[model samples]
Target: MLHGSDTKYRMFRAALLRGRTWLTPVCALACATVGASWFIADTMVERIAMVGSVLASASTAVFFAVQLAREVNRRNERLLALAGIVETTGDAVVAAKLDRTITAWNSGAENLFGYTAEEMLGQSVQRIVPAGDTTSLQANLDHMLEKDGMHTYEVKRQRKDGSLVDVEITLSPLRDLSGDVVGISSIIRDISERRQFEGEREQLLERERDARRDAEYARSLVEEQNRHLVELDPMKDDFVASVSHELRTPLTSINGYLDLMLEDDEDFPATQRQYLGVVRRNSERLLRLVGDLLFVAQVDAGRISLEMTAVDLTGLVADAVEGVRPVAEEKHLELVADVEPIEIPQADALRLGQVLDNVLSNAVKFTPAEGSVSVRAFLDGTHAVVEVEDTGMGIAPEDQARLFDRFFRTAAAGHMAIPGTGLGLAIAKAIVEGHDGTISLASEPGQGTTVRLELPAQSGSTESARYVETLL
Candidate 1:
C-alpha cells in the first residue's frame, strides 16, 4: 500500500523523467478513474464482486518505470557536473573525450603548458606529450583503463617557453553509462618553483661545505704561524717586566736620596731641592703606570686574587674625594660628595677604594675650570647605587662600549691631551664585577658621562665586617 505522499511523488517523478512524455498524464488519469470505479462498485453492487484492477496495476507500473528513468537522468547530470568541475579547475586539469581527443582544459593547464583551448581542443591526447614521453603517457592510459581508477606519477613536463618543469600527474579513467572506458581525466601540479628552491639550497649547502674546508685550511696555517710567533711575545713581556723593575729600582733609590738630602743639616738650596722633588713626583707617576701594567699581566696569568671583606663604602668615597682634592683645586673644579652613611656588602675595601679613586680622579682630570665633579650614593632595593657624575669633556657614544677594554683610550681623551694609562676603568670594571656587582656607563659627546656601580646591599652585623681572609 503506497502512501498518498508517495503516490504524488511518483507522479512528480514521472513529470521530470526522460523518454516518457505521454506517461505522466495517462498515469494520473488512470489512477483517478480506478478510484472512481472502486467507489462505484462498492456503492452499487452491494454484494461481493471480483475487482477489475488492471488500470491501477498499469498506473503503478508506469510510476515505477518513470521514477527509474528520472533517477538515471539525475545520476547522469551529477556525473557530468563532477567531470566539468574536475576539468575546469586551476590545479592543472585535463580530460579526453570518447573520440580519444583532448576535449577539456582549465586555466591552470593553459598557464602550465602554454597551450590554448582553440589549439588543444579536439586534438589527440598525444599532442600535448613531449616526443620522448608519448609512449609513457599511452602506457599509463592503458594501465588506468585496466584498473578503472587512476595512475599517478611525478615526471617532467615541457612548457610553452621550451623549458621543462617537474609536475605531479594523476590520471583517472572516464567511463560511459555502459561502464566502457571513453576518456581519461588528469590533474597536474607544477612544482617547478619548489624544486628550484630545493636545488638552490642544495647548492648553498655544497658551497658552505667548501667554505668550511677552506676556513679550516686557513686556520691551520694561522695556527702554525702563531706557533712560530709565540717565542717573540715572551721576550716583550720579559722586557716590559724587567725594564719596569729596573726603572722602579732606580726610582726608589732616587726617592731615598732626595729624602736624605732634604733632611741633611747642610741643606741643599731650596730651588734645587724643589727640582729634585718634581723629578721624584714624575718618576712615581711613571712607576704607577708600570705597576698597572704588571697588575694586568698578573690578572691575565690568573694570579691576581681578591681578598674580600666588608667595605665602608662611605669611607672609600670620602677618601677618594680627598685624594683628588689637590688635583681638583689645581684645575679650579669644585669636587663635591653626597655620600650616604650606609654600609655596602662584602668586597675588598682597598679594591673598592681604588675603583672610587680612579673614577674621581678622572672626573677631576677632565672637568674644565670652574666645572664640578660630584659623587653620590643611595640605596636601590637590595643594591647600593653609586654614581659618579662630572662636568667634563664627555665621551662619545661610539667610544662608550670599548671604555672597559684594556688599553682602549677614546679619541676625545686624545684630543683633550689627557694623560692616562687607559687601565684604570678596565681594572675598576674587573674589581666591581669580581664582587658580583655590575658596572655600566652612559654618556653623550658634549654632555658628561655617568659611571654607575650597582652593588648588593648588606643587612646587619652578620653581613658587615665579616672578613674572610682568602684569595681569588
Candidate 2:
C-alpha cells in the first residue's frame, strides 16, 4: 500500500489522465448531436434555426479540439527534447518513484555506476548507495519532500564493483499533470579529482608548517648557545690572566738565579756547568711562554696599547730579517731580503716589529736544510705591501683554514716535532688589524708558503688613531 502522500499523488494522476481520455469522446458526441438536430428540422425557419445553433456549437468544439491538439504536440516536443538532453549529457540523470524505486537511468548513469539501465530499472535506489550512506540518502529524500523543490548536496556513492566515488547530486521534484509530486529526478556529477587535489594541497600546507616550526626551533637553539658562550668568555679570560701572572713571577726568579750560576760555571765541574746552562735556557723559554699567554689575555680583554710613530716599514722588515738570519744560517737555509724603502706616516713601530718578527721567525724555523726564505717590501699606491715566502714543509689544505686560531697546532707540525705555541700568527693578526691592515697566507703541502701584509701608508688623523686603539 502507498503512503498517505503517495496515495494522494496516485489519485490526482488517475483523475487527470481520465479527464484527458474523455476529451475526444466529448468532441465526437457534440458532432453527433449537431447531425441529429439538422435531420429533425421540419419547417424552413426551424431548419435554419437548428442549423445555425448546431453549426455554432460544432465550430466552438472544433476550435477547442484543435487548440488541445496543438498544446499536446508542443508538450510532446518538449518531452522529446528533454529526453534527448538527458540521454546525451555527461552528468548522470536518474528518475526514481516516491517509494525510492528506480524508474529511469541515462547512459551517463550507466557509465558512472558501471550498471546498465536494464539492470537498474525497477531496483531500489539503495542498490547504488553505500552501506554507511543509506541513512543519508533517506534523509535527502525526506528533505526534498519537505522543501518541495530542488536541492543539491555531495556524498559518496558506490559503483557496481563496490568502489565508492565522490559525487555532487542535485535532486528535483518530478510532478504529475495536476501539479502533484510523484517522483524525484537527480543530476549526479563526479567530484573525485577535485577531492584528491584538495587532499594533496592540505598535506603540502601541513608539511610547510612543520618545516617552519623546525627552523624556528633551530634558530632558538643557536641563540641560546651564543648567549652561553658570551657568559663563559669573561671567566675564561680571568683564569688565563691569573695563571700567567703566577707563572711569570716564579719563572722570572728562576731565570735570574740560573743566569747568575751560569756566569760562575767555570768554578764548578763541566757537567755541572752544562746542567746549569740547560736550566737557564729552560727558564728563559718558560718565561717567554708565560709572557705570550699574558699578551694573548690582554688582547682578548682589549687592553693592548699602541704607540703610534712615523717609521720606515722597509727598515723594520730588514731588521727582523737580520734577527732571524742567524737561525736560518744554523739550519743551512738561504735567507734573502728585497726592501723598496717605504715609510708609514703613523703606526706603532714596536707592534709592527713584533708582527714581522713572528712571520720571519716561522719562515726560518720551518725551512729544511738548503731551502730558501725570502722577504719583500714595497709601496703599492697608498698602501705598504710586505710579502714573505719560504720553501718549508707547507701547511696542509685542511689545517690552513684554522692556521691563525690560538693554540691550534697542525697535524704536520706535530708529526715533525716542530716546537711552537701556535700563538704567533694569531697575535700577528690582531696587531696588523689594529693598524687597519690586512694579512693573508697561501700554501700547499710539500711545496711552499707565502704570507702577505697590506697596510695603509698614511693614517695620521686623530680619529684614525683612536679607532685603531679601540680595535686592540
Candidate 3:
C-alpha cells in the first residue's frame, strides 16, 4: 500500500527515466488512466453491477488522465521559463560535460565569442582558453570537482577572432535527479576594460614616485650649496680685517707728513701748498675708508666692547651738531639742533657719540649749499627718541631698502660723485641696535630724508646687548 506522496514520487521517477520530452508526459498520462480503470473494474464491478459500473469506471479513468496531464504541463512550463531566463541573460552561459566538451551554448555566448551555437556545441571548451592559460583552467576544473558545488575565477580566454580577453567565470556543477554530477554550467563575463583601467592606474603611481624622488634630490642639492656658502663667509670677513689693519699705519704717516708740510707755508711756495692740500685731502679719504673696513670687521667677528655709563642724551646731540657745523658752514647750509634734556640711565657715551657723528656727517655731505639739516631729541613713553631730518638729495625708493647694508650706496650719490665709503648708516644702525634700540628711515626721492632712532629708556641686559652686538 503506497502513500499518495510515494505514488507521485514513483511516477515522477519513471517519467524522468523516460526523458523529459512531449512523448514522456503523454505516456505517463496513459499509464495513469490504465491503472485507474483496472483498479475500478476489480473493486466496483460486483458492487454496482453491469452497465452502471462500467460507466463509473470509465469516467474515473478519464478524470485521472486529465489531472496527470495538467500536472505534467505545469512542470514543463516552469522548466521552459528557467531555460528562457538562462538564454536571455547578458553574460555568456555555457554547459559542458565532465569530459570538458561543450554541451550547450546560448545567444549570449554566440554574441560574446562570435561563435554560433551550431559551431560551438560538442566542441572542446579548451578552444576558447588561451594556450598559456590552459594549465590554470585545468586546475580550476579540478578544484570545482572536489568542491562539488560552485566556483568563480578569472582567466585569459581567446575569442573566435583570435584576440585575447580577460574574463571572470563562475562554474556550477549540474546534477541528475539522484544528485550525481553530470556536467558543469558556467557564467562568463568579459573584464578587459576593468583590467586596462587597473594597469593605467599602476603606471600613474610609478610616475608619481619618480617625481617625488627627483624633487627630494633637488632640495638636497640646494641645502648642500647653502651650507658651503655659510662656511666660506667667516673666512672672507677675516681676510678683509687683516688687509685693512696692514694699510692703516702707512696711510696715517702719509696724512701726518702732508699736514706738517702744509703748515710750513713760508718755507714752501704757494703753488706747492695747493698740491699738498689735494694730496692731504685724498689721504684723509683713504684713511676714512680703511677705518670703515676695520669697523665692519670688528662687528662681523663679534668683538665690539661697550663701556656703559650714565649720559645726557641732549649733550650728545649738541656736540655732534657742533662737530658738523664747520662742514655745514663750508657748504653754506644751515645746521639746527633741537635738544631735549633726557638722561639715559645706561649707555656707552663714546659709541653713542660715534652714532650721532655718522648720521650728522651724512646729512651735511648730501645737503646742497643753502639747504638746512635739523637734529631733534625728545622722550616718548618709555623710550628715548632722536630724529635727524636733512634737506639733501634723498635716496631713491629702490635703493632705500638696502641703505643699511654694508658698502651699499645710493644711485643719486654715486651720480653726484659725493665721496663716501657708504658705511655711515650701517655702522650707526649696529650701534643703536646693540643698546636694544631701533633705527628707521622715511624719505622721498625729490623731497628729503629723515632718520629716527628709538632706544629703550633702560638699557637691555648685558647678555642681550652682547648677543645683539654679535648679530650686527
Candidate 4:
C-alpha cells in the first residue's frame, strides 16, 4: 500500500530539472528581436513574428510530451505497487540476483524457507537450496537468460531447518527499460504437505494390497489344514460318517469288534486295552476338530441360533470361573473375577456363557504357573465392559493389531503350542458383536495382555434393580 505521497510513488529524478531545452536561448533571442523591430524595422517585423511563432510552437509540443511521459510513469508506479502487494501477500516470493545471490524474499518465502530476508539476502542462492539442486539451479538461470519469456517449473527446495519441500516455482527474468537482462523473480508455493498426504495414500494402498495377498495365502494354508483335519480324532459321529462314506463302512467294521470285545470283557488283555485307548483318543480329537469347523461355518454363514433370555451376568461369571478354577489351580495360577453388581438388558444366556467360557479358558491356557488371570466385568454408562487380563507371554505390537483375526496366533502363541482350535476368540467376537459390542486388546511384549469387550447395556431394562456379585 504505497501512498501517493510516498517517496516510492514520487516523480522520477529525470523529471526534476531537465535543463531548459537546447533551443531555449534561441527562442529568447527571437522574442527580443520582435520587440526591437516593432517601430524601427517594420519590414523585419514580419520576419521576426514568423520566427517567434515557429519556436513557440516547437516549445509547446516539447512541453506536452514531457507531461504525457510523467503521467505514464505515475501509472506504472501504481501498478508496480499493486503487483508487489499481490505477490508478497501469498506464501512465497523469491528474487535472485544476476550474480546468483538471493536478493529479495517475501512473507511466504519466510514461511517456506524458514529464513528472513536479512539471513537470505546477499547470500549465494546455494545457501538455502539443497546441494543437489545447486548445479541445476545455476543451469536453469543460464537457460533462462538465453530463453526469453517467463519460465515456470517445480523445484525441491531446502528449508532453514534442513527439511526438504516441494515448491511450485515460476521464474520471470527482470528487464530494464531497454529490455536488458537483469535478474529473476519467482513465485514459490509450498507443496510439502500435499506431497506427504499423497505418499501416505500410496502407502495405505500398498498395505491394502499386501493384506489381500496375505489373506489369499492364508486361505491356501487353511485348505491344507482341512486335509490334515480329515484324519484327526473327531467329535461328531454323524459328521465323520457323512464326510467319508468309505471310512464310515470301515468304522462300522471297527465298531463291530468293539462290541464283541466289550461283551466278552472278562478276558481283554492289557495291550488290547492300550490299543483301544489310543483309538478312542484319536477319535475324540477328530470329533472335536470337526465340531469346531462346523461351528465356525455356522458363525460365518450367520445360521447359528441364539436363544435370548434374562440371566444374571454375575452368576454367569461365577459359573465360568468355577469351571476353570481346577485347571488354573493345576497350573498353580490364580484366577480372580471382579464382576460388578449390575445387571444388563436381556441376553442370550447360553451364548454369552459360551463366550465367557472361551475367553477364560484361553486366559488360563496362556498363563504360566503362579501367573494370574483377572476377569473384571462392570456396567459403565450404557455399556458392559468385560476385560480378561492375564500375566502371560504377551502379544507383540505388530501381532496385536490382528489379534482378533481368525486363526491368527502370535509368534509367542505358536512357540508354546498352546492347545486351541483358534476359533474360540473369533466365535466369541461374532457372538459379542451380534449383540452390538466391540472387542479390543491392549498388550505389550513380556508385560501381559488385556482383551477387553464392551457390550451396550440393554436400553430400556431395569438393570440397576438386581444386585451383581463377582469373584469365584
Candidate 5:
C-alpha cells in the first residue's frame, strides 16, 4: 500500500542505481581508449602526455554525458506512461499552475467538460469552476500548498453546455525535481447522480418525520376527547336519575287515583270505565319505564346496594315460571317447569328474582301460539343452574350479540310489533353479574332461544350489588 509519491520516489532511486551500473562499464572502455592513445604516441611523449590528459578529461566528460542521457531517457519514459494513465482514466485529469492557469487537459477532462486540450490549455482553471466561486478553488490550492499533500472536496462545476454537475475534486500538489510544489493536479469525478439520489433520500426522510408528527398530534386529540367524555359521564347519569324520580312521583299518584276510580264502576258509564282501564294500563307501562331508567342510572353511578341472603334456587325458578304461565296460556303456548332443589348461600333474592322474572317473561312473550316454554333448575357441582328455553321465532345471530345492551331492540321484535322498552335483559344482566353470576343466551334464527343462568352456590363467592362493577 505505497502512496503515489512514495512509489515514484522509490522508482526514481532504483533507476538512478541502474544508470550508474551501466555507466561503470562505459567508464572502463573510455579509460582503455585513453591508454591506447597515450601508448601509441611514444615518439611525441610530451605531446602524448598532454593529449592523454585531454583524452582523459574528454572520457570523463563522455561518461557523465552518457549517464545524464540514460537518466533523461528513464524520466521521459516515466512521463509518457503517466500521461497515458491520465488520459485513459475515467475521471477528469487536469494539471494547472499555481496561478490557476490550466496546463494539461486529458481526454477524460475533455469528455467531462466538453472541451478540447487546445481550448482549455493556458486558459484560467476558473473556466470550468462555477462563476463567483473561484475563492474555493484558490483556497483549495493554497491549502494543498500549505500542507504539501492531496486534499479532496465536493464542488459544483459548469460544463460547456452551461449545465451544472456535482463533482468530487482531489487536488494533489505536483513537485519538480527539487521537491518544491510547482502546480496542482486535480482528479474530478462526476457525483451528480449520487447527490441527486441523496437529495431524494433526504426528502423521504423529511416526509416520514412529518407523518410521525401528524400521528402523534392525532393521538393527543383522541386522548383529550376521551378525557372530556370521562368528565361528562357522571353528569349524564345524574340527569337521568333526577328525571326518573320526578316522573315516578307523578305516575304513582295517578295510578292510585285511577285504582280508586276503577273500584266503583257504578259511578261511571261503561265507556268511561273502559277509558279508565286504558289509562291505568298506560300509566303502569310508563311507571315501569321510569323504574328501568332509575335502575340503569343507579348502575351507571355505581350506587347499587344489594340485600344478600341465603336463597333456594328451586323455589325461585318455580315462582318465575308461575309468573309467566298466564302470559304463555294467553298465547296458547305450553309452559313446563322442572325443578331440583338447589341452594345459593349468598345472593340478593330481590335481584335474583328480577333476573328470573325477566328471562321467563321474555320466553313466554316471544313464543308463538302452540309453542312450548321450558324452565329447568338444578344443582350442577358447586353452582345452581337455571335454564329457560323457548320454542319461539328465535333471535338472529347479529341481534343476539347486542341483546343485553340497554335500549337495543331486536329486528325480530320490531318486525313482529312486540311491545317492549328493550331494557329487560340489560337490567337482568347487571343484577346477575352483581352477585358474581353469569347469564347467557343461545339462539339462531327460526330455531329457538335458550337462556342459561349459573350462580356460585357458596356464601363467600358473591359480591354485594353496592360494591359490584357492572361491565355492561
Candidate 6:
C-alpha cells in the first residue's frame, strides 16, 4: 500500500529506467562480441559490432528522450487543470511580485475590479488599493513576506469604475523550488453584502440591549415604590392607633354622661330622656368602632400580646353563644350550640374568646327572623375546631374573598343599613392568626354562610411570636 507521493515517485523511476533495461545489456553483449572478433582477426565483425553498439546507445537515448517528453506532458496537463480551476473560481485570485507588481490575475479578479488580466498585469497592486489604506495594506504584505503561511484581512478597495468595494483578502507566501518566498498569492472575496448583514445584526443586538436596560429601569422603579410602601405601612398603623387612643378618652366621658342622663328620668323630661338614649347608643357605637380601629392597629404593628394558658374550648363556645343570644332573640332567630369538651393546652383564652364572639355575633346579626345559627366546637386531629353555620343571607362570591379585609362592607349590609363597622371579621382573623390559628369562610349568595376557625392545640410560645415579628 504505497502512498500517493511514493507511488508517483516509483512510477517516474520505472519510466526513466525502462529504456536502459534491455539497451544496457545489448551494448554489453556487442562489446564482448567485438573483443572476441578482434582475436579471430575479423575486422568486418568488429565494425558491425561497433555499429550495433552505436545503434543501441542511440535507441537508449531516444527512449530516454521519449520518457522525458511524456513526463513533461503529464506535468503540463496538471498545470492546465490548476490554471482552469484558478480561472473559474468565484474568488479573485491574484499573484504579485515582492515589489507589489501584479504577475497574474484571474477572471474573478477581472469581474471584481473591472480590469482584465491584460490591463492589470505588470501594474502596481496599489492601483486597486484605496489611497487611505495603502499603509495598512503594505504592513499586511510585509507580514506575509516575513511569515510562511497565510494572512487574511478585510480591506476597502476601489474598482476601475471608482466605486468602493469591501473585500476579504487571504494572502499567502508563494515559494520557489528552493523553498524561498518569492511572491504572494492572494484570494479575495467581495464581502459587501456580508458587511451589510453584520451591520443589521449589530443594530438588532443594540436594540435588544436597550430594551433590556429599559425593563431593568422599570423594575428598579417598581422596587423603589414597593420599599416606600413597606416603610409607610407601619407609620399608617401608628397614626390609626394614636388617633383611636386620643378619641377614646373623650368618647368614654361622653358615653358616661349620656348613660347618667338616660338613667335619671326625674331630672330630665320625656323628650330629653329620649335624646339622651339616642346619644348614648350612638356614643357606644362610636366607642366600639374606635376600639376596633385600635385593635387592628395593634395587630398590624405586631404589638398585640397574648396571655397563653390552657382553657376548655367548650366553655368558650358556650359563653360566646350566650353573649350573641340576645341579638338572635331580638331578630326572632334560633341560636343552637353543640359543644364537645376539648382542652387547648396552650392558647390565648381571651383572644380565642374574642374570635368566637365576633363570629357568633356576625351569625346572629345576619340571620333573618326564624333562621337558625348553629355553633359547633370539637377536636379535629391536633386542632381545636369551631364552626359557625348560619341560615343568613350569604355573601356573593366576589365579596367573599375580601370578607376579612379591614373596613370592607358588603353591598347587602350597606343597603340594609345594618349596624356594622366591617372590621369585625378582620380583627377576628388577626386575633385567631396571632394565636397560631386560621379562620376561613364559605358562603354563597342567598344560600348561607359558614365560618370555620381552626387553632393549633399547642400554640406557639411568646419567644416564637417575637421571632415572627422580627422577621416582619
Q: What lDDT would each prediction earn against the true structure?
A: 0.72, 0.79, 0.77, 0.69, 0.79, 0.77
| lDDT (tens digit, per residue) of candidate 4 on 285-353 | 555555555556566555776776666777777788887888887898877777775455767888788
Best of the two (3, 5) by TM-score: 5
| Candidate 1 Cα lDDT to native | 0.72
lDDT of 6 by residue, 39-140 (tens): 111113233345445445344333433445466557667888999999999999999999889999999999999999999999999999887774877889
Deviation from native of the Cα of residue 329 in model 6, angstroms: 8.1
Per-residue lDDT, model 5, residue 120, is 96
Give stretches of model 3 more than 4 Å off. 1-134, 140-204, 219-234, 265-286, 318-337, 357-375, 388-426, 441-450, 458-472
Model 4 TM-score is: 0.42
Which window of 10 residues has the lowest lDDT sum in candidate 5? Answer: 463-472
Which residue segments of model 1 deviate by more than 4 Å? 1-123, 142-148, 158-167, 174-183, 188-247, 250-279, 300-302, 305-326, 335-357, 373-390, 394-405, 428-472
Sorting all predicted structures by lDDT, with the top scorer first, yields: 2, 5, 6, 3, 1, 4
Comparing 4 and 6 on lDDT, the stronger one: 6
Candidate 1 vs candidate 4: the TM-score winner is 1
The weakest ten consecutive residues by lDDT in model 4 span 35-44
List residue ranges in candidate 5 displaced over 4 A: 1-95, 102-123, 132-134, 143-148, 265-274, 323-337, 360-374, 388-423, 441-450, 458-472
User: What digit string (tens of lDDT, one per residue) describes model 3 on residues 1-472?
Assistant: 1224765445544453333311111112332353322321112223324423444435443344334445555666788898999899989999999888999999988888999999999998998988777487778888998898789999888889998889899999998867899999999998889999999998998998899999999989988998997898798788888898888989999988887887787797888888888898888888878888888888888987778888777778777888887888888887777655676877899889989999889888888888989888777988888898999888888998999998889888888898887798888888898888999999987678999999866433333211100000
Backbone clash pairs in model 2 (N, Cα, C under 3 Å; residues 3+ apart or in different chains), count: 0
- In model 6, which range of ten residues has the least summed lDDT? 463-472
TM-score of 3: 0.65
| Winning candidate number (TM-score) | 2
lDDT at residue 412 of model 5 (Cα atoms): 78
- TM-score, each model? 0.56, 0.72, 0.65, 0.42, 0.69, 0.64
